[model samples]
Target: MSELKILIVDDDPVTRSMLKHTLNAHGYLTAEASDGADALAKMAAETFPIVISDWNMPNMNGLELCEQIRKHDSEGYIYTILLTSNNAMEDRVKGLRAGADDFIGKPFNKDELLERMAAGERVLNLETREALIFALAKLAESRDTDTGLHLERVQRYARFLTQELVGDPAFADEIDEEFIQLVYQTSPLHDIGKVGIPDSVLLHPGKLSKDQFKLMQSHTVIGADCLKGAIAKSPKAKFLHMAHDIARFHHEKFDGSGYPDGLVGEKIPLAARIVAIADVYDALRSRRIYKPAFSHERSCEIICGDAGSHFDPRLVAAFERVHEQFATIAERFSEPSELPGSAEPKELEMVH
Candidate 1:
């Protein structure tokens, strides 16, 4: 692997010299900036994965520099490590609040600096991988679900479900903020492999034949393969790989009754299992060529009946709490075919 480019921003020449020598000896390439202005200029010229900057400088100090970096880009993350002579609690808090990835006390230990920089590198790599994964997810959604709104609605439903679960004491730690946000953003890709399924099956107006049902099931494998292929190209993308697991296993049931793989109970990945309930609920309540949409109440009844039989009981409980949000989502994204008098199902209310 090529050496990571490190940018040093310290007014003191001696400190820069020592850092450069220490980092070079450890096989990292170094760049120097006497002040924040120079550092920002250098940053614009070339992308440096890690920046070690002294907290106090003439103009555009390290804290300001970190804030500016945070504002400027969306594609790549720049890790800023602040060097501080000030040991005040407020000073450290300010630096972190301004976006410095780490703050090192003045007279920083060489080994500690190296360790912190390594940690910063890990964070930057993770950010880059996430960007790539999200891009691929967008591509997958665009290809399969023709309407641009499908992804939005699915993600919204996932977020609502996750938020409801996180609020409950039982799932607070398990569905932390990061996991909830990731699942909310990536859950829409569950149907990505529908792109690979023939339109004849995907757009059929009636129930699928046994043979066609078998073929339709291949979408899970196909979607997983697409993401696996993406990971083969970019091995650092861990979240994309997680999304692949969701796409492949979301259909698997809690009672060993679902498609592709019949994973049962906790055997299914938690994220995938959560997504399965959300996906089926949305699919049932949304209009599709094969069937008219079900009423929100009937959809809830169907899902409630399947607790522990087709879904995780805990998630089903969560779903029950947030079922109203699902109705809101249906109202927001109901297709034209699902509008009033459009092949009205017998049991559904004709909500005008």
Candidate 2:
């Protein structure tokens, strides 16, 4: 019901102003771009729910901009409306083929345009809510510099494990598709508490001393507290509750030796247990400032060796069943190899 942010891209100043004022009068926040190139620039710098672009422009055409927006794999979806003076049916079909969502012919009707904009706003609201939720998980990934890609890779691995568990005789009855997805999406926040941990301990180049290690272990509690605070504000945030359990207990050991709360065996949350194995495996295989990366075979050996002690034996068995899936995730997000002092972050933008 609030104002929807809409971008108007047109080469003619008169047309752009008319559309902006018309849309703004209907309770929409407006942004304007003179050409397709400027529109793309705005698209990168900010988030817009819908783009109303003119077909003909100086640099790139509306169709080209539509194609570019389609290619970006990100959180929010951009509903594009191409403005064209051509009224031919073939031109409209071509525009749709080129990725235009809804086309408005030039000499557009104010009422028709408003109706289309309303529908686009409804679709965008759902996308915006989903984007906000995923953004929180991204924040967890941001805190741990060395744990880069752990949040991403583990989600894929968790999905695979959960999917398999849903078919297993022991877990099939309790594990449903919805439960699996919620766990997959929310599991990455398992280490969200690390945000509260000091960089001296988190970014230390070597193993932590006894006290430092104990202090480092408190991140689980901190993460849970932070997630609890968020849920306190919005009780409808069911995912946050799931994330709280995972964050608080992911470090717990199967043999009851892990930190914060030494939960044993099946006593720990299943979501936490699943993430624990995947986290450790990804951590061992990925490069970090403190330790060198280990090979897949060696990391697998360590995981299987510590099965009864470090992880739940049943979950470890589930992991072995989906080891290939883990390998795929690792290879997909694998860190580039670089010699000492020669590494640089591959110029990747903060997406979503």
Candidate 3:
């Protein structure tokens, strides 16, 4: 295993020195902080995935530190371990509620410490899994030459809409921080099934025939089935479950008019409903072989016009509120080649 840089926070110099020496001896890099406050300062300046802090301190205790860490806008997860002699069940509960991942007795055992670190490493390894998921999504996207940054833009739009819906009473029970993150991470896989589409149909330079369009629509099922297989192997992967839902249902219309399964209204998975709006909006704004890119205002009008027919009305309302932000994100990630007047139109490919 590669060495992990850990921050040791405690007011006791001896304990800090001992812990740092033990960690460094075991191929782990160590940094010392006098208290939780000091640790927070260091964290603000540097990235540390693991934090070992004592329960008792002058400025801030370990529990406080854990709470602060959880509240901080860090880009990645931080595994926090609290060191305390207090063995009371209530104290342990308090630490857990404060966001502590693990606890160690005041007189810590070296083997136990290392084992806990290993467990934390395993948790951090989820990051690697998420990266692999995106790579797989990218592989599917590679089949289409015209979808430059489509995945990136769609994920952002989905995340933005989901974030806005967090305040809505109708979705209050559904959307949360984890939901928002999952939408952002899994939205890119919405079209992964397109890989199964034959080039003759997927890359056709003209409008698809009735049979070809039917085959083209099968990409949703193909992608969903691929994720279903992965889910069968790892049933507990929440991201896969969401990705499966998005892949299968993102193309479903809100008014019972969509394909594969005519799931209408709230019956469609909420994640899929949210992604449908995002995907369509980006598709409208993006340049396609058959259609030129639409302006932000024009895109908004089309989306708003189809609020109840193509998208969930609640989500459409949320989109209306954040339409400006969506345009900003689109502009930020827009490919220069996709911009208007940058390139002449190519042979048309049928887009769903």
Winning candidate number (lDDT)? 3
Candidate ranking under TM-score, highest first, comes to 3, 2, 1
- Assess the local accuracy of residue 107 in candidate 3 as a C-alpha lDDT between 0 and 100: 91
What TM-score would candidate 2 get against the native?
0.59
Tens-digit per-residue lDDT, 75-119, candidate 2? 456788998887687676566545566778787889989888887
Clashing pairs in 1: none
lDDT of 1 by residue, 107-205 (tens): 889999888878877766666545555566677566435343556566667766765564455654566545755676578678788778887876666
Candidate 3 local distance difference test against the native: 0.84
Q: Over 4 Å off in model 3, which ranges? A: 1-125, 341-352
- Tell me each candidate's TM-score: 0.58, 0.59, 0.67
Residue 195 error for model 1, in Å? 2.0
- Candidate 1 off by > 4 Å: 1-148, 167-173, 340-352
Worst 10 residues of 1 by lDDT: 343-352
- Order of candidate numbers by lDDT, starting with the best: 3, 1, 2
- Local error of candidate 2 at residue 134 (angstroms): 3.6
**CA lDDT of 111 in candidate 3?**
90
